[model samples]
Target: MDDVKPKVVVDPSAGFCTGVKRAIATTEKVLEGDGEVFCLGELVHNEAELERLNHLGMKILDKNHLSRTTIGSHVLVRAHGEPPETYKVLEDKSVKITDATCPVVLRLQQKVKKASEEMQASGGSVIIFGKASHAEVIGLLGNTKGKAYAINKKEQLDSIDFSKPIRVFSQTTSDQNEYEDICNQIRIKSSNLSNGNPDIEINNTICGQVSRRGPALEIFARSHDVVIFVSGSESSNGKYLAGLCKSANPLTYTVTGTGQINPEWVLNAKSVGVSGATSTPEWLMLKVAAEIEAMI
Candidate 1:
């Protein structure tokens, strides 16, 4: 008797959000030039993709390399926009810059900057609901001249002074459901602190594409018996989405690429789903699907 092979389905919605694709496409165009170009940060969170760029002669310029930068040298900003100071530093060096900031993030930064200015004059607070150390948050803080407060979770809101007027903004990639919950709690806290006069402003700043992904991904995760979530270790978006898959399917497993797929994952499954993060390349997902096909 012939052995049965599990059917594998790759999530059509997975891989390369609009912002990341724009950033990478910009980088690739620069790479085509023979002259050197420096990327300020990991262009994307995937190690395999990074390695591919490196092989193509991409140079990454960390802070240590800043001083070595010469005038007229080209530098690229990834989708994760940097703080204003980064631009100032590059400008001071007279370096040419290709800013590939996501248009959505650019708008968010502008909004945060304006809100920061307003809050500074009002003696209120500008609250950013995001990881404090994330590059995007760091950039947002720069807009506020380092005066804005960043909160990773709702519990951190205790540190905020709700008596004053408050403006809340969320990172583009943060979980939408969690951000809603945090805003609700903020409203409750502000009402109690201000005698039911909650002087609070909540802006839904999360990118629409990312906000919509969770629901779609959850559905994809449950449609098959086994789900393989592909993403680099460094991507927070990947981590969040992979967790969503795991919640929907107990057989979910995470890997950065096809190399990490295990034969056991497909040995017992009648159907498998391949999914990935916003930073993941579509080609990688297809490869993972092909590898699983070979195994089962």
Candidate 2:
């Protein structure tokens, strides 16, 4: 039994991405001095990280909170940027805004805004390859003044008049492979609609960090006998990356934290690799590794 105990290895590359790191650091800096800072939404998708931040006196709020914000209160616009109207409400209520939007997301918002303006003038359409309900997608559409179409599923393509000109952009954290597939489908349909001369512009708007992380995680997944994927359950990309790990190593299992790990999953495994989503905190991953060590 001692010889068979699995050696737990936490992936060094698995942890918060640069943008999430920046957001967490910014929030921590504010919380340390300000006490009870208001965040517009969950700072990051990882629930464990959110819990840690919440314990540190971060108050998470929704859009409705914007309307009722007390005058001169400090409000944090999370990494998932908000609509212009959100800023307007905060300003009207005299809330001090600390913008912590990711730089990649901010640039995508600007590009989508400009594209929508151009499309509006020429009777074209701006299409977003992302979840319609995602906070970032909502912000992207707001930049277009509610003029852009968000296509999360291929079936939603029916809503678009592809016969007209089109521009495509993706949420910064969207699955890169999925984005490409959606773009290809859109392009093919547009060509069929417009007699092979589809007028379309697709922007490489997905975060380079997300785009590069997939391949790296795939390699990491393949290198391990068993993979424990840690991430907030609500994270969209977490599911995708975890799926990548599952694909590479069928013994992969996902958990929000150490307590969720199943001892049965690591049975007969000689080497267990632990990895996490971009929003996952490094300390959480380390704790998970320790838990795995205890289990084995």
Candidate 1 C-alpha lDDT tens digits along 125-197? 9999998889889889998999998987778889888889999999998877788999999989988863764
The 0-to-1 C-alpha lDDT of every candidate, in the order given, reads 0.88, 0.88
Candidate 2, residues 81-130, lDDT tens digits: the string is 99899988888888888999988889889999999999999899999988
Candidate 2 colliding pairs: none
RMSD of each: 1.6, 1.4
Candidate 1: the clashing residue pairs are none
Clashes of each: 0, 0
